[model samples]
Target: MSGHAAFAVTVDLAVFTIRDGIFSVLLVERGTEPFAGSWALPGGFVEADEDAETAAWRELREETGVERFEGHLEQLRTYSAPDRDPRMRVVSVAHVAFAPDLPAPAPGSDAANARWWAVEDLLDGGPDAPPLAFDHATILADARERIRAKLEYTTLAREFVAEPFTLPELRRVYAAVWGSPPDLGNFRRKVLGTDGFVVPTDTHGVSASGGRPALLYRRGEATDIQPPMLRTAGEDD
Candidate 1:
């Protein structure tokens, strides 16, 4: 084992949620060096005894104070470029998570601040965009596309809504992620026709404008959407 090189493993999370009709991702301002004061995905080095996923969840709670997450979580990819982290040789296992109406974040010990940033603004490379630390800009972009693609054929959109949500509410989730609203008539037909995609309940949601009450529904038992709600070319623009 003499002359063997050593490297550390870390976990980075792209925690996404729809906030105020905008697709947002959680970010933290680094409190220490390597990228001090720059924005980055919430994460930390994995402990010797824990796995990457466990480290992800642990860092999530420790950094964001989101103790209860009832949504989707999965490994996205890994980054192991020798120079990705300036401090030392490090490999990062990135994770993607989604939920609805997450609470405001309080910065963890290693962060100066924490908040949600619209995914488009961050990825747009505009004047207002914060320079992301490490390779997180790439990670965020990948996570954004992953969620968008999943919505086309999977019931992943349901993770962004609470139970007993209306069709309009569900459609908004699609709009927020895809950046364009799917046609109302087509969206309704596709959702209702897709077996086990959603289950109707006896309850209704009151509209803010005092309009007629809309029927509410909960996510059903099925995971895949039959016939696949494909996103067309112009729908993303």
Candidate 2:
């Protein structure tokens, strides 16, 4: 039997957020070799003292300068393809997070640059676009699929909005996440009819068009959305 050689494990994060009605993702330009000058998901090798989750959170904070992320953060999956990393045999445990707001980031550690990019622009692969390092493009795609699936049956959509938000704001979250604009009336009925989905705060948001103020609501105690909001056939980002 052949003896096992050394294998290193790393943690990466695919952090997502919505700002100015656009879906954005946090990315970093690698400062070191193995794909220097390339854009990648924020992450690094796990330290001896920290577990995967701790490492993910620490790496995210270090790269993005966002200390507190107010949204759903969870492990997406482990990627162990043989040639995924050019260095040694590396297995990356990629985590995903969805936050409502993120502060301006200052690149730190091995990241040469840090910024939020529009999802459409990132996938466009134009001359000005930065290529993803390692196997990050696949990881980012997986993260997007996981988020879409979660939206169908979980309360995760609420995490993309402020505490007290209008129905339009919440619907925008759904549309942004799904990359498709759902029918407004149908969406409103589904959300309001879903028990424990949201509770009105007896307040309204001023209409930007100077019409009637829109009613505001907050997330309820329910974690699951009954009659899951399924995506349609051929619907894609």
Candidate 3:
């Protein structure tokens, strides 16, 4: 087999969370070239005899030391830039995972250290911090767009939220993405009217509003978010 015909496979990860109302992603500081000292998603070369997605899962655990990958995990895209890795022609299989919270984020393997960076911080990251390795900037961008879109169409937003959430709490998730307050009446109608979107768990009921501690609800198994929660325009300002 010709050596030139063989290709290198690398896996990059996008681990995201929302803290204090700001969306954030996990990143590591690279020690080696091809963008050394710069923050990049946790990932590495695929182990020999390992499958691509398997490699992604393993690399994610090794690099992030997370307990599990049971939540929403999906392949974001493949990056095959010839110069992605200066030492060889590397192809990266990128993946993204959404976690609700964290205990800690310590850098593992090639990274000097790992930390959760506020998406706003990164979005506002100036040219001075350090350039990202490979096309990680693009990878993170893709993950974010998917997250935003999915939160609208699926009951997926619940995964990021806690159970028995106050209507106000649930509304906040929408405000985070849409950046606007939803009409109280319309928003409530859409969410409650939608079958399987949420199930009222409290037997008697309590209102979220101080009025009566409105009905407490839990996440329902229904996967589809019917009558989709459409927000008013000017949603990303």
Best by the lDDT measure: 1
Per-residue CA lDDT of candidate 2, range 30-149, in tens? 899989999999999999999999999899888767786667889999999988988889999999988777777789988899998877677757467677999888898899888888
Model 3 over residues 1-237: C-alpha lDDT tens digits? 765657889888888776776577888888777677888888888889998788877776677676564578888888887877777788998888876776467667677878777665565574544556777888887887777776666777676667776667777776665445677777777678778788887553455455756566888878876545556533322
What local distance difference test score does each model get? 0.88, 0.85, 0.73
* TM-score pick, better of 2 and 3: 2
Q: Would you list the rank order by TM-score, best first?
A: 2, 1, 3
Query: All candidates' TM-scores?
Result: 0.88, 0.88, 0.83
The clash tally of candidate 1 reads: 0
User: How many clashes in each candidate?
Assistant: 0, 0, 6
Error of 3 at 5 (Å): 4.1
Q: How high a TM-score does candidate 1 get? A: 0.88
Candidate 1 off by > 4 Å: 2-4, 201-215, 233-237
Q: Who wins the TM-score comparison?
A: 2
**Candidate 2: how many backbone clashes?**
0
